[model samples]
Target: MSPRRRRTEEFTSYYGRPVLKEPTWEALDIAGYIFAGGLAGASSILAAGAQHTGRHRLERAAKLTALTAISASVVALVHDLGRPERFVNMLRVAKPTSPMSVGSWILSVYGPLAGASAAANVLGIFPRAGKAAGIGAGITGSAVATYTAVLVSDTAVPAWHDAHDVMPFVFAGSAAASAGGVAAALAPLAEGGPARRMAIAGAAVETAMSLTMERSGKLSAETFHQGRAGTLLRLSKGFTVGGAVGLALGGRSSRLVSTLSGLSVAAGSALLRFGVFEAGRASTRDPKYVVVPQRERLEQQGRGASDRQGAAAGADSMG
Candidate 1:
């Protein structure tokens, strides 16, 4: 007679469902908002630099891009709200600890300044005032690029929370890359040198930060390379590398090359946002992510207690 086989213990959550709350954010609305907000924020910085440096083509493109991207980002955010009116309520109180509240304030401050800056340039309204507004936008723009990372990382999402230290840098670099891509695509060839340089620098930072994130978490970081998230992140890395290489090849003369490079970087930035969002969802979906960490913590507590008890017993014997 054949011996009966024993099965390994299986880990399960309630009805085999996630023990954590899956993010309620819709992919297109939230993901698109993240990409556009990043673009707007970084473009504002580029616009300010171009304005200061007297690069007319780059300044014009960056200013207009910032305005357009921020407007689109607002629409995406409103679209994601179940009750759009609740967005207005978000501004009623300030919560320093709350990223969402801080983000709302940042947008409010950045939006009008960005709009005024672009409008002043387009309509020749108030150059001095517009420049001042543009500067303000530039200052606030950095927060816009980074605050979203804090928003996601502050949550229970394992992938995001675990990578909190690097998330801001990752998002900031991606934002800069997207903005640089826009400038590269829209500005004249001679004026696009800074844009190309910015693209390369941003890509390098983003790639390095992302790699750091993946390597830092060991098993937990597997969320980045497991399924759909893995596929998108890998593709984002490929596009980022390709875009950077293209920018290097294009130099300052090839408009077509610049355009392709810009497009690739923009695509890569968007894919990275999508990848991170999807990774968070993946982390929540699997029980192991939730269970394993907790189990380890409990084991650690047990060992700590045992060590304390042993030390106390030894002290008592000595006494």
Candidate 2:
């Protein structure tokens, strides 16, 4: 008689369904909002630098870009909420613990300040007020660029939550890359040196952080390298790196090269945001991504407790 084979239980959820609900966010609206918000936030900071350095063309371009990007982002956010009042309602209360509530207040304050800065630049009025507003916007814009990472990571989604440690740096780098890219493309060659440097530095940081997140060895990290998410992230890295190289090699001497490189960097930044969003959504569809990690954590804890008990027993025997 053949020995009876033991059946192994597979890791799965009840009825073969996912353990977590998939996020309902529309890809275009949410992804676009993330990209635009980052661009606006980083551009405001670049605008301040340009203003202080007397790079008038770069300053004007960055200020206008910040205003336009922020407005578009607000529109996307409102549309996603299904009604304008839904967005306004968020401002009725300030909840520091709630990313949505805090983001709402940040947007409200940053929007007017960005508008004032752009208006001052274009209309030639309230010079002093505009300077202060620009400074204030820069400070808040830094938060705007990276807070989406916190918002997404704060959720139950495996991919996003697991990436909380490196996600903010990824978003911040992408933001800087996009903002610098746009400024470089719009400003004259002579005024584009700072933008070029910014783009290069940002691209390097983004690529490094993304790699770190993907190579974290966590099961959730696998989601970033599968199917649609993988393709988008690959393209993002390629474009970002290629653009940075182009800027470094020829941006100083050739306006055409600078423009193309800048556009590539901006596109890469957008793709990075979309790729991350898709990865998080994909993770929710698979039960193993969630269940396996949880099981592993429990096993580790059990092992630790057993080791401590063994050590205590040994000490008692010695005594």
Candidate 3:
């Protein structure tokens, strides 16, 4: 007789149907928006910093990148909506609990500030006013960097919803790296020092957060390591690692190496966003990803209830 072997566990779901509706968001549009918004947000901060420090070339490049990326992000978002007219109506109301509403408002405030900063550079007018707008963009930049995390985690998707605590940091770090990469690529070699440092720091943070999420996310983490999403995430990790190493080796001495590193980091950031989006979609499609976690939650609640009842019985007997 053959020796008995352990079988992998499988979870069943009601009627073999997905427990949650997959996001209606198109991968190209929504993922692009997420990546571009992050890059724009972080670049705005870099622009503001450069402007204050009187680094004209860096300021202009960062500001232009911010404006261009944000504008593209807005376009992607509107296109994803299908009913483009409703995009305008999004501004009509504000709901604190609604991440989407909050994100729209953040963009409204951020987009104009970024555009004004870029325009100020182009028109060579309102120097002080432009500085103020750049500062405002920098301030609102946090929202632009991390609000997408709120947007994704607020959903029913198990993988995304479970990793809410780390998602914002992941996105934030990725955004900063992407912006830094762009700055490194576009700014003069002499002015690229800060960008290089930012890229290195951001890459470190993003990699750490991703590793933590994968280790601590329980079953939800499985989505990040399976099929297409898995492939993309693995690629992102490799690119990020390679970029970080290149930056470290090149330091401030090699502009060519810095530029190449910047490209790698930017590509990694894009892949990270796309991979995350695909993972969330995969989580929704698989009934086990949804059902298993919920079943665990119910079991935990049952245990708590039983313990409470047992405590009550003991208290009555003592009385």
* lDDT head-to-head 1 vs 3, winner: 1
- Give the TM-score of each candidate: 0.94, 0.95, 0.95
Q: Rate the local accuracy (lDDT) of all candidates.
A: 0.89, 0.92, 0.88
Q: Worst lDDT window (10 residues) for model 1?
A: 1-10
RMSD of 3: 2.9
Counting clashing residue pairs in each candidate, in order, gives 0, 0, 0
- Residue-level lDDT of model 1, residues 102-170, one tens digit each, is 999999999999999999999998899999999999999988878889988998888998899999999
Which of candidates 1 and 3 reaches a greater TM-score? 3
Q: Tell me model 3's lDDT, rounded to 2 decimals.
A: 0.88
Which residue pairs collide, candidate 3? none
Give the poorly placed runs of model 2, Cα more than 4 Å off.
1-10
lDDT of 2 by residue, 1-319 (tens): 3111111135658899999999999988899999999999999999989888989899899999999999999989988999999999999999999999999999999999999999998899999998888888888999889899899999999999999999999999999999999888999999999899999999999999999999998878988999899999999999999999999999999999999999899989999999999999999998888887787779899999999999999999999
Q: Which candidate leads the pack in lDDT?
A: 2
lDDT at position 263, candidate 3? 84
